[model samples]
Target: MILIRLESKGPIFYYSYRVGMGYKIFKFYKFRSMHTDADQMVEQLKHLNQYANDEAQTIKTKPLTRSIIAYSNHDHILVKDDELFEESEYEQFKALEDKKAFVKINNDPRITRVGKFIRNTSIDELPQLFNILIGDMSLVGNRPLPLYEAEKLTTDKTVGRFLAPAGLTGLWQVTERGKAGMSAESRCDLDIEYALKHNFWMDMKILFKTPLAALQHENV
Candidate 1:
C-alpha cells in the first residue's frame, strides 16, 4: 500500500508523500503546504459546538462547496461508496479549496507578497528534488497529486498504471503548466501515459524541451 506522512518540528513542518512499490515506502519531499499550527487549529475547531453543527450540514451552495461535493461524489464511487470523510471534514475542505483558489487567481488575494514569486518561478517545487534524488521520483515521470484529483481519476483505472516514480517535470508541465489551468491530478494521468511509453531518447528530448518550455513566461 502507498503511504504518505506529514510531520512538524519547531515552527516549521515537513511533508513526504510516498509510494509503496516493490514492498518499500519511498519518502517524497515537498515544501510545507500548511501552517505549523494547522493541526492544532483543526483540533480546536472540532471542539466547538458551532463546528460540530457545521460539520453535519450538506454542501448545496458556493462554487467551492459544489466542487467539493462533486469531488466527494466521485470519491465515493471510486471507493465503492465507502465514506471517507465526515460531513464536516468534507465541508472544511471546500473552505480550504476556496482559500487555495482565491489566492491562486491570476492575482490571488490570499497569497502573501512572497508567495507569488515562489509559485511563478516554480521554486516551490524545489523541495521535491529530494524525492528525485532519493528515487521516489525519476527525472521524467508523472506528477503526484493532491488527494482530490487522485480520487476522481481512480475511477478510470488507468491512474493505477501511472504509479511509477514521480517527476518534477512531464508532458503536462511542458504543455499546460502555465498555459492552462490543468489540475495537478489530470496532469498526473497524462504524464503516466507518456512515461509508460517512453524510451531513453525520448526522455532526453523531454529534458531538452523543458528549458524552452520554462522560458515561455506564461505564469503571469
Candidate 2:
C-alpha cells in the first residue's frame, strides 16, 4: 500500500508517497522543479488570495461563493463552510461562476531554471518508475493529484477517477497533453471516461502511445 505524507510549501501542497513496513521509510527521489522558498511566497499570498495570471504579470483573486468558503492557512487557502471563513475574518464573497476546477498558470515564475526543461520534456516524471516498481503507482492509471486538488474531488460526480489506479500517465495527459487552457471540468470528464472504460487492452494502447505524446512541445 502507498503511504502518503502531505506537506505544504506556501500555497502549494504536494504528497510524498512511500511504501514500507511499520516504522521504516524509504526516500523518493525526483528532480527539483521549484525554488526552495516557493512556499514562503505562497504564505504571503494567502491573505490576499491572489495568484499570477497566465502571463505571469497580473495578479488575480479567486472569487468565492457561499457554498465555497476560503480560509487561509500559513501559506495556503483551505476551503470550508461559510462559517469557517467568517471566523477566519474572510469577507470576500461572490456568486459561484463557471470556471475550471483546476487551474495551472503558464510561465509561472515559481518554476526553477531546470524545471522548464524537465517539464516540457516530461522528464520530471521519470522518478515515478520507482513508485511503479514498489507498487505505489501503476504504469497506466489516473494521474496522482496534490492534496489540495484531491480534496475538491469529493463529490459523487468526480469520485470515480479515484477508483482507477494512480498512474504515471493517463487519458487526459495523452489526449489533451498539447492543448492549452483546458478547463478542469473537461479534464475530469476524461478521467471519468477512462475510469469507466479502462481495461488491460486499453491500458496497453495508452502506454504504447505515451512516448509520442510526451514528445509533443506542450507536454508541460
Candidate 3:
C-alpha cells in the first residue's frame, strides 16, 4: 500500500509498494518538491524551450556535467550547481542539488508555509523510518524515482540493480539533495554511479551521513 500526499512539500514524493517477502504493503515517503501544476506547466513551456534552443547558438557540452545557467524559464528547471539546499537544518542537503522530478522550480509557487519548513529541515522524511523497519528500505541506497523517470533508465543496464531494495536515505539524497542548485537528472546520474559501486562499507558511510544531513538547516 503506497501512501502519497499530492500536497507534500518535501524534496521527494513518498510512495510505497509490497514486493513480496510476506511483508505488508509498506508506506514509503519522500519530499514533494514539484509544483501541483507541474505537468501542465511543462507541457505549456515545452515548445518555448525548443524555440529557445533553436534560436540560440549550440554549445556542445558533456552530459551530466554541472551548470549554473537557470533552466527554469521553460518550467523544466534542470538541476544545476546553484540550487544549493541551505536550510541550515539539512546542511547535508548542500551536497545534493535542489531539483524535482519534472519541473524543478527554484521558488516553486506550490510550496506552503509548513511545506517550506519541512522541505528545508528534511523533517518530511521522518516517516520513511517505518519503511526501513519493515524492510521496504535500507539505511542506504539510491533514492527511488517515479515511474516516468524509471522508464528513461531502461537502457542504463544498471536500473534494476539500483532498484533492488528500499533506501531510508541514499547516495542521491545525502550527496545530491542541495537546497537549490544542480540539475535533477545530474543527481540521478550520480545515484546511478553510487549504485554501480555500492558495498556494505559504502552503505555504512551513507548511514552515518544521513543524520548530519537531517540536522542541518539553511536559509528558509
Candidate 4:
C-alpha cells in the first residue's frame, strides 16, 4: 500500500465492475498497478491487441478495463450464430471485434514502478481474498472478466465457463500463463474445460501449481 502511495496519487485499491459467473456483475478488486489515468488511456493504445487471427481478430496495443493486469491475473470467444444477437448487440460486438476482445501490452507504459513490482509478484491480487470470502469469487475457478471483454464471450461455446466460480487462480493461470500462442479462444477453452470437469482433486492440483504460475517471467 505504501509503495503504491509513494509512486502515485490515487486509491490504493482498484475496483471495477467485472463480469462473473452466470454473467453476474460484481466489483472486482486489486492493488492499483497502473497510473491513475490508465482507463482513459485505453483507446489510444488499441492497435497492439495480439491475435494470431485464429479467426482474424486484428491485434492492437489493446485495452484492459481492469487496472491491475498480467493477462489480468484476468482477460475470450465470439458468437457463431449472428441471429442470437439483437441488432444493437450485434453492432456492439462488431465494434468490440474491431476494438479487439483481448489485449495484453508487452511493455505497457501506464504501469507505475511499484505497480510493476506488485503485478510481477502477484501481490496485486491480494485484495481479492476479500472477494473470495464474501462469495464474489473463490480460491479456484475461472478468473472474472471486465465488462468490455465479457460482452464478447456469450456464445454457447465460451459461455460455459461461467458455470464455475470466479477465482484467483485457475487452469489458464497454471497452464497457459506465458505461452506465446495462447489465443483468446484457447483461454476460454481452458476455462470451459475447468468448468465442465473441475473437481476437488483438480482444484487442489491447480492450487498446487499456482505458486509456480504466479511467478511469471514477463512484463505486461
* Top-lDDT structure, candidate number: 4
> Which segments of model 3 are wrong by more than 4 Å?
1-27, 30-103, 157-164, 179-181, 215-220
Query: What is the lDDT ranking, best to worst?
Result: 4, 2, 3, 1
Give the C-alpha lDDT of model 1: 0.48
When 1 and 3 are scored with lDDT, the better candidate is 3
Model 4: colliding residue pairs: 47-60, 47-61, 48-60, 48-61, 49-59, 49-60, 49-61, 53-56
Stretches of model 4 off by over 4 angstroms after superposition: 52-99
RMSD (Å) of each candidate, 1 decimal: 11.6, 10.8, 14.1, 11.4
Q: TM-score of each candidate?
A: 0.52, 0.63, 0.53, 0.79
Supply every candidate's count of residue pairs whose N, Cα or C atoms clash at under 3 angstroms: 1, 3, 37, 8
> What TM-score does model 1 achieve against the real structure?
0.52
Output the number of the TM-score-best candidate.
4
Give the range of the ten consecutive residues with the poorest summed lDDT in model 1.
1-10
- Native-structure RMSD, model 2: 10.8
Q: Across residues 162-183, which tens digit of lDDT does each residue of candidate 1 receive?
A: 4554567767667776664544
lDDT of 4 by residue, 72-109 (tens): 43313223433222334444546457336667776788
- Looking at model 3, residue 185 earns an lDDT score of 52
Against the unseen true structure, what C-alpha lDDT does each candidate score? 0.48, 0.58, 0.50, 0.79
